[model samples]
Target: MVSIEMIVAARARLRGHARRTPLLSSPFLDEIAGRRLFIKAECLQHTGSFKFRGGWSAVSALEPEVRARGVIAFSSGNHAQGVALAARLHGVPSVIIMPDDAPKLKISNTRALGAEVVLYDRAKEDRDAIGARLSEERRLTLIKPFDEPQVIAGQGTTGLEIAEQAEEEGVSSAEVLAPCGGGGLTSGIALALEARTPGFRVRPCEPEGFDDTTRSLASGRIERNATLSGSICDAIITPQPGNITFPILKRLAGPGIVVTDEEALRAMALAFTRLKIVVEPGGAVALAAALFHGEQLQEDAAIVVTSGGNVDDEMFARALALRG
Candidate 1:
């Protein structure tokens, strides 16, 4: 289990590095849910996602000699960009392995950050195998997206900030919801909330098709989806939850909630129109949960962490049309 002291230390370490993203009250959401809604806009975070916080924290904690050897990662999008940018900042070479079907915009942006890109077909090739081979051959440090303790500690910073902001606004006992991919962000958020606000519930919201966390929690063990079917929320399509994250989530997060792709699209459009923020479908899952499944959450202020804002232009426009 992650400790509160570690979360506090992470916040201190990431103070100047990660943006202190705004925690704003959304009247539109409040009206719909009949309760106050506070959004932690991590979509505005550096590299357009909260993954940067963990990437930077992990790299910054490395020994000087290990840093010299450089780093490698496998990600669909946001984590790739996070590792790429964070490696560059630390004067280390970085390489990212991504599924061939990952967003072109994200791939291009990661390359723009000077990271070498390796593409693999999700159907025919295993990205983790490729990453392992590359790590062994190149003597590179592997940064598993959500499995490492350091990464979880790094991600905990976002929750720490939310807790502080919630307290300042006099909102107690918020039901904090975050989208679950491999569970890094949700687990980290739960750690911070558990430590700071005793009674607050932390929930992991996921797309219905790719809800491994929900199943894992229900079965009281790790579960795997045999295959990942694409969703509008591409970012949370991990075939299985991480070994490290599942146990933490089982201990801390409330029953995982699954929302549909249509619900996610509606939440994305709502964020764009009402908040003037363009959030990726994956990032909007928390809000979707609030909108579509409010009855499941405790009737108090709910803090929805919008995790990223890296939607492609075409996808963004299409989501708007679908929602309309």
Candidate 2:
């Protein structure tokens, strides 16, 4: 488990390295939700997602010799680019094993960031095993997307930022909705809030039919999704919660929420119309839950953590064309 102290340290280590993405305000969203609805615009972050914090956190923690040997990671998109960029910044070579079916933009961006890209068939090959083999063969340090303590602590930096930024905006209490994938961002934010903003609660939001984090919290154990490839919210469809992240989310997060694919599209459109921001489907789930499931949350005010905005042109057009 990662502590608040580690998160604080991560912020120090990431100084000037990661962007301090802003908390955006939308009067339209406030009117619709009937509360002060602030958006934590993490999509504006480096690599277009908050995953860079964790990648930088993990890679920067390595000993000099180990760092020289480099790092490897497996991801559908967001984390792939994050690790690639983070390793590049540290002068460390990175190898990314990504699903061949992952978004073209994500794969291209990862390679452009200077990481070696390995493609695997999601339905036939085990990405985890492939990553492990390459890591062992190359003496590369494996940076697990969310389970690593350093990664969690680095991601917790987002929560820390939200707490401070909210206080600056005179928000004494608020519920934070974050997209869930292996519970990394959600669990990390939950811990940060639990320590700093005691009145604020972090809630994990997921796409319907892929709500493993919610089910795991309910069942008091890890739960795996039935399938991984169906959702348009491709960036978040982790098979199960991380062993390290699940316990933290189970302990710190408020009850989780799930929204449908349509709802996510609606949120994406709304983000563009109201927030003037672009958000991918997986990243839009948090705002979707907050928009469509406001009654379920106890708080009058909330922060929707928009996690990413890396969609292809066709998908972006499809999201915008979606009707209520």
Q: Rate the local accuracy (lDDT) of all candidates.
A: 0.88, 0.91
Residue by residue across 1-324, what tens digits does model 2's lDDT show? 589999999999999999999999888888877677899999999999999999999998889899999999999989999999999998889999999999999999999999999999999988878987898999999999989999999999999999999999999988999999888898889889989988998889999999999899889899899988799999889999999999888778858899999999999999999988989999999999888889878888999999999989998888888863
Compared with the true structure, what per-residue lDDT tens digits does model 1 show for residues 104-164? 9999999999899999998999788899999999989998899887789889999888889
Report the number of backbone clashes for model 1: 0
On a 0 to 100 scale, what is the lDDT of residue 137 in model 2? 98
lDDT value, candidate 2, whole model: 0.91
User: Which number leads on TM-score?
Assistant: 2
Question: Per-prediction count of colliding residue pairs?
Answer: 0, 0
Per-model root-mean-square deviation over C-alphas: 1.2, 1.0
Error of 2 at 71 (Å): 0.6
